[model samples]
Target: MTSLPLVFDAPKRALPPRHLADLDAAGRRAAVAELGLPAYRADQLARHYFGRLTADVDTMTDLPAAARGELAALLPPLVTPVLEQSCDGGATRKTLWRAHDGTRAESVLMGYPDRATVCVSSQAGCGMACPFCATGQGGLQRNLSTAEIVEQVRQAAAAARDGALGEPARLSNVVFMGMGEPLANYPRVIAAVRRITEAVPDGLGISARGVTVSTVGLVPAIDRLADEGLPVTLAVSLHTPDDELRDTLVPVNNRWKVDEVLAAARRYAQATGRRVSIEYALIRDVNDQPWRADLLGTVLRREIGARLVHVNLIPLNPTPGSRWDASPRRVQDEFVRRVQAAGVACTVRDTRGREIAAACGQLAATGA
Candidate 1:
């Protein structure tokens, strides 16, 4: 049996010092004013951070040298790169970032033919305690501040624009599918989502539809997010369709069963008119059975309907020495067929960055 960390249900730790991303336009002005700086400097700083995508204080030549130092001190850096590894001939890159308190998290940048996506962590470690997840095994370190979450996206966007992942491209998509259960750190994650999707000179300006926030069926959070008016996709990590198996795979299922989760997802889809993504990690002999796939398809179709739900069949990316392994291609194919046959849309996810410990918490674990 796995030993769960005591911090699983503990309250969130104190957030780190305020960073620029934590504030909106008005808040930025207030922050600058508090620092004895001109209010207009706030917009300049915002432009540098969000529009220019540069965090280096020395590069802000528009500001006076002394003012730049003072402004930089006010808006301190949130994430320091600890390690970065690339795979898929540089198309997929993973970065390990160390926060102010020394807690570490990771983010992944993947460049596809049409889109560049960055998967960012919302917490230093995860409390979900999903047995097969690297992040979950480590347990919760602490929730990341809104700025800490936003910094990951900023860094990834910079990398994408710099051609770090082949030809220069804009970061077109962001996914909260790294390190932690995003909805677990609800407020901060939502703020970060706003920061990512808001228009430029104010935020990253990425479209809300291009962003995805995944959770392990945090039902209340799902319902709350549906009302936020952000049409970002909601991905429920439903590794198994049955409550009994799901209870073991996603411990949160103990509180809200499979049906409750799918119901909440249905509400979200109906509210946003965006199809909910059902994430099913196909662990060999665990939750990859054909019958389970059939159940998954039936339940999703019955609850959320075919138009409002899509299944993303993930091949389990086993951690080092983990008991879990990916289901064979034969099994995986059959599972996809079963779900599709039930009149549901399903596709195998394009796995990436496994060789470089791209999965959340893997880099931090190895570093520790």
Candidate 2:
């Protein structure tokens, strides 16, 4: 047989210089000073970006006319919207953002009767290497800056306030479940959380309770997050109950076993007094077997009791060329029943954004 060459467009490795939100309060002051502006201007700029959620230099009228232009120039737009595709007639909008380095990521803004939620990406691509995920298939691109992440919320807020979704509304919730494993990008993710929940005239001022961070069970990261003193919900993506399957479904599980991961989650719950979210993706004839569900319920009830856990079952969203598919309705319902039977609260997550490649990595792959 003749030798063959394998080739494809190699993934981009380097991301652009860090955004302002990537820095902490002290770091922001240094950056502002480096820009030749007085230290006080850092707080002023933060007030505009984090508090007022505006990056337009023209609209930051609080600063001196001379300084506003200089400050804005230093902190230029970090995330630019490439496209906003809406499905369900203005109720759901999926936005594709092109970062400064041309790396693309996405976020979904959903408007409901009681709340408006935005699902934000922490990285342009994922490194977890999960076989069925759209983003994981793309490989790791780069971690997003804190400002890049916050800018997504700002844009969503702007859209909500401007009647983008029928009537002027406020962004009520934010979930870090879109692209990369948020805990893997720990530093920047925590910084973004601070910039998000900080008080008025300083940060976005969104309630900590309304923010949720999803991770693939990075144990140490989970424990550290609990100490941050922010009451945001923690969601662990526990696709399978046993280590045998999780080792393949979530590559990180290979490093941290199922028991270790669940223990970490329990510690977080105990420390934070907030119920941890257990996310399980049900695949037909795969992890959705009724026996597996029984085992899962046993693990949850034994490892983390009902008081500290709520299971959210996500039916697999079939990606192009993937062998995976969602479980049949009957199997799905039975799995839920088994878990609930074990006394762990369980419910099926609402499937959305399917019509527009709304899943995290789908839009980037299509655009590429």
Candidate 2 has which clashing residue pairs, if any?
Answer: none
Give the TM-score of each candidate. 0.96, 0.93
- List, residue by residue over 268-348, the lDDT tens digit for candidate 2: 899899999999999988899988889988998889888899999998888877899999999999999999998899999
- Model 1: per-residue lDDT, tens digit, 84-152? 889999999998898887889899999999999999998888888999999999988888989999999
Q: List candidate 1 stretches off by more than 4 Å.
A: 1-12
CA error at residue 116 for candidate 1, angstroms: 0.8
Q: Candidate 2, which segments miss by more than 4 Å at Cα?
A: 1-15, 35-38
Candidate 2 displacement at residue 347 in angstroms: 0.9
Cα lDDT for residue 85, model 1? 89
The CA lDDT of each predicted structure is: 0.89, 0.85
RMSD list, candidates in order = 3.5, 5.8
Give me the overall lDDT of model 1: 0.89
Q: For all candidates, what are the clash counts?
A: 0, 0
